[model samples]
Target chain A: MPIITIRLAKGRSVEQKRDLARAITNTVVEKLDVNPEWVTVLFDEFDRENWATAGELHSDKYGKGFGKIGSQEYPK
Target chain B: MPIITIRLAKGRSVEQKRDLARAITNTVVEKLDVNPEWVTVLFDEFDRENWATAGELHSDKYGKGFGKIGSQEYPK
Candidate 1:
């Protein structure tokens, strides 16, 4: 089960997201040889204030630190 | 920007998820005093085949390692 979260620049449409998801599913099905239905992807479109990097935030990435997404994970 | 992922037991209902999300958002809004709209959460549900813990995968946690989400991240 390879669920990947792609955080791209916002403003992407639903069609673009579906295309990305389909392409990813097809790649896994072809290369790793897995069923397509098992592949699930979710696109979370958030305002820049929801993500953060370093001491600054995505909001600050532009100017003011309005919103930011702190992308950190712990393997457990 | 603190985007937290809750890896809970599968089979949670849409209502349960919405409740949890709302609770979390409220907590941050109350305790941390963050904005509501700035809080974005996504629920990733799989058939115990898309998440991993340590060496064994979630699927292997049941039987075979059908799928695995190797939760790892780098502090950038």
Candidate 2:
């Protein structure tokens, strides 16, 4: 089983997850030549207080509502 | 950085997570010889509806309140 775990900040909508799951499953199936049913995608959503970088918490560095767009680690 | 992700059924207590993080961090540090700060332990909690095995959803396979005591994938 190809278990793909994506670590992302919390607050993503269900639509985002649905789209991501489909896209990622398709990519994995095409690239690895595996069955789509064999692929599993798990989203690990983290709170700002729990996430840190360079010993600084994301809440302090990025303020609030950072996850809706992206994190400091993955600015978009 | 060594990021360790644990995919488990939801409903685990914070105490369980705290214990697991510390234990896993120590193990990673000892085995990989990495600093504790460089290791990240992320717990991915999935609802039964979102998790599946053998083409069957966990919610359907195990009924309700299945996550409180591990899952069919991990009998413990």
Candidate 3:
């Protein structure tokens, strides 16, 4: 089984998760030659307060609402 | 940099996370010879509805309240 873990900032809609799961399953199936049923896509949603880069928390460095729409750190 | 990701069922307390992170960071630092600051521990907490095994969702297979406590699938 192939488990794909995506770590991102929280606040994504269920619709986005659905899309990502389906697309990730398809990609894994094609790339790895595995069955779609064997592929699992797990989302790890993080609060900005818990995520950091270069010893600086995202909450303090990027401010709020950056992950929802995407920014330099989280490209669309 | 070493990034360790833990995939587990949801409902864990922040105290547990703090303990785990500290212990894991120490282990990684000693084993990999990396700085504690270079080791990143991420928790991927998944609801039963979003996690599945053997083509069955955990919500349907294990029912509710299994993940909160130690179960066959999740050991304490």
Candidate 4:
């Protein structure tokens, strides 16, 4: 069994997150020969203010977007 | 903006987690002179089976602890 934990700012859509998880899980499951049930994935999402990039907080420093990912669906 | 991403297994108390975040935030704030509001902290909780240490998943490979961190307090 393997567990994958990923932390990224909340901006990507449900499709993106789900696809990312699926791709990651599938890669590890096949490579490590682990059972599907053993593969657990968690995505930690944070607001721009809570997350930072480069040298500033994503909110104050990078207002590239706002309130972007509040209604994203989680992929199973 | 600078984003710091950390990945760790979920077996810490709310106090512990809050304390950890506070310490981290205080460190960055003092050292970097950044505003407290700019410091956003997030904790992603996962089951033992969803985490891994050494060469095994946190669950099957290590049951040394279980249901350990669920009802702790989350400090502000």
Of the candidates shown, which would achieve the greatest DockQ relative to the real structure? 3
lDDT scores in order? 0.49, 0.71, 0.72, 0.60
TM-score, cand. 4: 0.44
lDDT of 1 by residue, A17-76 (tens): 576566645644543334676555555556556655676666656543222333321112
TM-score of chain A of 3: 0.83
Q: Per-residue error at B41 for model 1, in Å? A: 19
Rank order by lDDT, top first? 3, 2, 4, 1
Residue lDDT tens for model 4, A1-76: 7889776766667787789889998999899998888999988676554444333444555554534433333323
List DockQ for all candidates.
Answer: 0.04, 0.10, 0.13, 0.10
Model 1 — interface RMS deviation?
13.0
What stretches of model 2 exceed 4 Å from their correct place? A67-76, B1-6, B11-44, B48-76
Per-residue lDDT of A1-76 in model 2, one digit per residue for the tens? 7887677776665555666667877888899988877977766677888899999998887766655433334333
Looking at model 4 chain B, report the run of 10 residues with the lowest lDDT sum. Answer: B67-76
What TM-score fits each model?
Answer: 0.41, 0.53, 0.53, 0.44
Give one digit per residue, the lDDT tens place, for model 1 in B1-76: 3354443335545665676566645544443334677555566555555556577666666553232233321112
The CA lDDT at B32 in model 2 is 99
- The residue pairs found clashing in candidate 3 are none
lDDT of 4 at A65: 53
CA deviation > 4 Å runs, candidate 3: A68-76, B1-8, B11-44, B49-76
| Candidate 2 C-alpha lDDT tens digits along B1-76 | 8999887777667887899999999999999999999999998778655554433455555765544433433334
lDDT of 3 by residue, B1-76 (tens): 9999898777667898999999999999999998888899999778765665433455655776555433534334
- Residue pairs in clash, model 2: none
The docking category that best describes candidate 3 is: incorrect
Across residues A6-72, which tens digit of lDDT does each residue of candidate 3 receive? 7788766555566666677777789889887787766667888999999999888777654443343
